[model samples]
Target: MSVPALEARGLVKQFGALLATDDVSFTIQAGARQALIGPNGAGKTTLINLLTGVVEPTEGQVLLQDHNVTALSSSQRVRLGLSRTFQINQLFPHLTPAESLGLAISERNGSGADFWRVAGTRPAIVAEIEELLTRFGLEGEMDQPTRKLPYGKQRLLEIALALATRPRVLLLDEPAAGVPEEERQDILAALSALPADVAILLIEHDMDLVFTFATRISVLVAGRLLTEGEPEEIAADERVRAVYLGEDAG
Candidate 1:
């Protein structure tokens, strides 16, 4: 069988006396849409950190495709086709989306050191930036300072920046956390349009978005793997309802 796009085996993390992650194991198959949902403090962030090398695992292994990247740095992981968005938007306040994306793409192509000098003149980088802006629906505001764009657009741009790396596996942490209801559809539409060949692991609290985007869902509680199943199966699982989903899980 082909190796999964991303895999975590026997993952564990300890901070002082607390166990942040406990024997966690999961796989994100190529092109799969997976959601990881849990209540606050469920160690969701810790798990993402472990996968991306934001912190080392106390005991476990992280694999990208078939390669063992357990000891790789965060930058190393990104170069290996693993990319992620944080719960908080990490945008350069003063730079326009075009500049940010140009820098990211240039870096990925080993021309980042001169991105500023070539941003306006490089045909290839400019083309890719324009393409990504169009893909993320930021064409109208592509040249505006990132801080001046609407919060939802800023969020979308952040995702676009991640995509600039052309990752095989994408990890999204609460992509809609602060997006207003009126603007959330834009985020949804953008996510729905992503290439099917890229595996996605979304960590979010919005159940509606979760059901609409994920074919499969994993529930986490108290730093452990609670259960995982299809969208319907998870919605009907009483254990999930009691702990995280609550009475209106569906």
Candidate 2:
């Protein structure tokens, strides 16, 4: 059997008496399209934290391509081909989209300290930044500071930044959140166009995006894995309907 791109095994996290994640475990194969959905306070954020090494799990392990990475810091994990976006935008407000991508790519190449001074000197870096911005549909806005761009564009730039690291597994934490309805299609398009070799684990609440993008879905309830199945199975599940639509599970 082939190893998964990402795995969380028997994970648990506790902050004092509050158990944030309880024995949660799952895997995403290379190029898999998966979504993690749950009601509010279902421990989704905490689980992402554990997976990305933002917080340590009290118990259990995180494995990337079958290597134990539970002890790695977040940056180490990023270097090991694991990267993530955020629920809210995480971008440099004053940096243009081109500058940001250049910096991220330069950092990944270990030359960020002097990237700004000699950004135009590197043909490879310039070509990559152009490719990424063009891929994300930000070519027109490349020269504007991130804060000057629309919320949706800012979000797209953040995703592009995460991709700059060339991760094998990408965790998207609410990529569509706060995006206006009209701009959402752009986000969806960029996501659908991601490199097929990269496994994406989307954590989102937009049913439209979730159901449309994910082939497999995992539902969480109160910090535990409620169930995981194909989109059809998840949609037809009574417990899932109850959690989302306020129907009675009993």
Candidate 3:
């Protein structure tokens, strides 16, 4: 059997007396689309941080493809094929989307500091960057500065940048948070179309998109994993319905 694409075993993180993540444990199989859902302040982002090495866990381990990664730094984790996008947009405000993606791809290829070398001068790299932007539906706006793009477009660009790293596992923290209702579908579509080789661990509040995209769902509450299973099973679970799904009838 193949090892899971990502695993968090007995993970724990605390800020003073606050237990941000309490003994969290879960595994995301290769090629799986998994949703990590919880109400606000449920430690979902903290867990993402732990997995990506943004905030070191107070205790427990994070494994990427069965390799211990708990001790790795964020950049080291990215180099190891683990990548993520933030809840807030992170982009080069003045650079065009094309330029931003090109830089990202170049960095992933270890040529980031070659400022003297123009990305457009490299046909292969330029072509690849254009393809990524087009794939994520940002082709027509490629030449526009990131700050000029709509909020939804900026979010999409962030995902595209993470993809440029060619990650084995993608961690998305609230991909749809600030997106308008009309544009949310585009975000969902792009996320659903990620390559099968890439396992996704998504932290999202949009239940419609979450239910539609997640093959497996994990529920967290009070910094602990409450339950996890297939969407239907989760929906039918009495405990889940009573606590998390009370607003929607089972």
Candidate 4:
């Protein structure tokens, strides 16, 4: 059998007496578009933290391409093809999109310390930055400082930075949270253009984008895996509607 792109097995997290994640287990098949959805305080963020090595699990393991990465640090995991974006934007406020993405690509290449030489002297890296900016619809804003860009564009640029790492499994935490409706299509389009082999585990509350983008959906409730199925099955599930998605979710 082929190994999954990412997996969480019997994961648990606790803070004093609060159980943030409870025995959460799931798999993201290679190249799958999977959505994780639940009401607020459902432990979605905790789970993502555990998966990305931002926090250690009280119990269980995180696997990347069949290798155990439970003990790895976030940077080590990124080197192993695991990368994620945050609920809030994590971009260099002072840097332009091109400069930021160049830094990311350079870091992943283990040559970030040599930026002065690499940024201008490396044709390949320059080409890659241009490609990423164009791919994420940031070509027009490439020279503007990230703080100067609109919220939607900043969100897109953050995702672009994640992509610059060339991850095999990408965990996106609310990529559309603060983006306005008019600009959401830009985010969606960029996401749709991701390479087919890059598995995306999306944590989002926007039902429209969720339903339209994910082939499969996993519903969490109070830090536990409530149910998982195809988008249609999840949409029709009464339990899901009552606990999370509204009755009119479909």
TM-score ranking, high to low: 4, 1, 3, 2
Q: Model 1: per-residue lDDT, tens digit, 1-250?
A: 7789999999999999999999999999999999999999999999999999999999999999979999999999998899999899989999999989988898788777763574657898889998999999899998899999999999999899999999999999999989999999999999999889999999999989999999999998999999999999998898998988784544
Q: Which regions of candidate 4 deviate over 4 angstroms?
A: 115-118, 247-250
Q: TM-scores of the models, in the given order?
A: 0.96, 0.95, 0.96, 0.96
Clashes of each: 0, 0, 0, 0
Q: List the residue pairs that clash in candidate 3.
A: none
Please list the Cα RMSD from the true structure of every candidate, rounded to 1 decimal place: 1.6, 2.0, 1.5, 1.5
Residue-by-residue lDDT tens digits, candidate 4, 62-103: 999999999999999999999999999988999889899988
Report the C-alpha displacement of residue 96, candidate 4, in angstroms.
Answer: 1.2
* Runs with alpha carbons beyond 4 Å of true place in candidate 3: 247-250
Candidate 4 local lDDT, residue 43: 93
Superior candidate under lDDT, 1 versus 4:
1
Flag the better candidate by lDDT, 2 or 3: 2
Error of 2 at 56 (Å): 0.9
Task: Write down the lDDT of every candidate, Cα atoms only.
Answer: 0.93, 0.92, 0.91, 0.92
Cα lDDT of model 3 by residue, 1-250, tens digit: 7899999999999999999999999999998899999877989988898999999999999999999999999999998889999999988999998988887788788887786876668888888987898889999899998899999999999999999989999999889988998999899889988898899988998888889999999999989999999999988888878777775554
Model 2 earns a TM-score of 0.95
The 10 consecutive residues of candidate 2 with the worst lDDT sum are 241-250
Error of 4 at 131 (Å): 0.5
